[model samples]
Target: MIKHAALVSFLMHLDYFDAGNMDSFVDDLTVIPAGRGTDAAGQIVVCEMEYTGVYGIADYPHVQYPVQRLLAQISAWLLDHDTDRTTPFDFSVNVETNPRDDSKADLEIRIPFREAVTASADAGGELALAGEHYDVNA
Candidate 1:
């Protein structure tokens, strides 16, 4: 099992356009055409993982729980939407800010799809991601 601290460390060191990680999660996103990177809206897709409310070594225990849950949620979301079971998006992150809260951060994962049609999931034309449970924006 990946510890919260270690996971946090790994996440922090990750780059949005890291080729290795992008290739690994490609299947979780969309299928890429042979030479199609000329979409009107660009070919980059982003997935954001948010972590809010408090931060510290002591919070590691509590922090990890949500992280694991979020990971699972993302997996399910991808499985449900990805028909081709592949995506070529690059991942990124977005860290929010809170005056009252101790910590506020968001992780964004992105992919570059040949077309929006390929990036879409089977959700009746709208990507309503489980009522913002995971906030999956494709």
Candidate 2:
């Protein structure tokens, strides 16, 4: 299981805010369909709703949501998918930063249209997991 705490810290980095020493890093990280594909963009969209444990209801201006919140969201998002995977998933949007390995380096997600996970005779309905040859089909 990916360390929720660590992933949380990493996501925080994406926010581009100046919150000091937020803890958003992952440990024991693993990927579903393991090593599915290469880096593609515009797959995920984020709707950051809060910052520094602050959420809004009425409305605020120029609010900077904590980056870690988004990271945690991504960690949670990965948990929802099937490890074996199914069909080509077009996109995965979240307020979190994209996942990474132990070093906090980006673990490229976002497969392209063509590279998008798909069913195959050999692999069955299993979506392509990360693989050495996996390039974003898009």
Candidate 3:
């Protein structure tokens, strides 16, 4: 599972928008397990994970362009981080105005990742869970 703080830090590092505006732009970040699959040995070997969040952006007259650019940057980052360029990632985004604060709008995003988990033996011959590999299309 990806740590929430790590993901937030990554977003702040992106150049699509000023990092100073992050606190106002992002409301929440969550990582959840969507599904799982087993390998031939009946061991859980694959997982479907999701990163869901709401971005509360200030309602500038031209908010859409910056939001769109930010999404593009996120997509590129996901692709670059993908370990396996095979399966496709599922990404969804929705934009809407905040109910209580008309001056702020919400950019809801759901990013899905398919991860492969395997068991490997280290030099000590102890079996250990290897690192996860994201399955994403090239």
Each model's lDDT: 0.31, 0.31, 0.45
Residue 96 local lDDT, model 2: 24
Q: Tell me the tens digit of each residue's lDDT in model 2 across 26-107.
A: 2232323422222433221111111122111111111244335544555454455323234434334323233333324222
Model 3 ranges off by over 4 Å: 3-6, 15-65, 85-103, 122-138
lDDT of 1 at 80: 54
Top candidate, metric TM-score: 3
lDDT of 1 by residue, 21-137 (tens): 211122233333332222434232323222221112222222334445544544454345433335413322222222323432243333222222222334343434433212222
Error of 1 at 52 (Å): 24
For model 3, residues 1-138, the per-residue Cα lDDT tens digits are 443344557776664445554542223334343334444332433334343444443432234345567667766666677554363444444555443244334444444443444322234433333443333211
Better of 1 and 3 by lDDT: 3
Q: In terms of TM-score, which candidate is stronger, 1 or 3?
A: 3
Better of 1 and 2 by TM-score: 1
Stretches of candidate 1 off by over 4 Å are: 1-65, 86-104, 112-138
lDDT of 2: 0.31
TM-score of every candidate relative to the true structure: 0.25, 0.20, 0.44
Clash counts for the predictions, in order: 23, 30, 0
Candidate 2 lowest-lDDT run of ten = 53-62
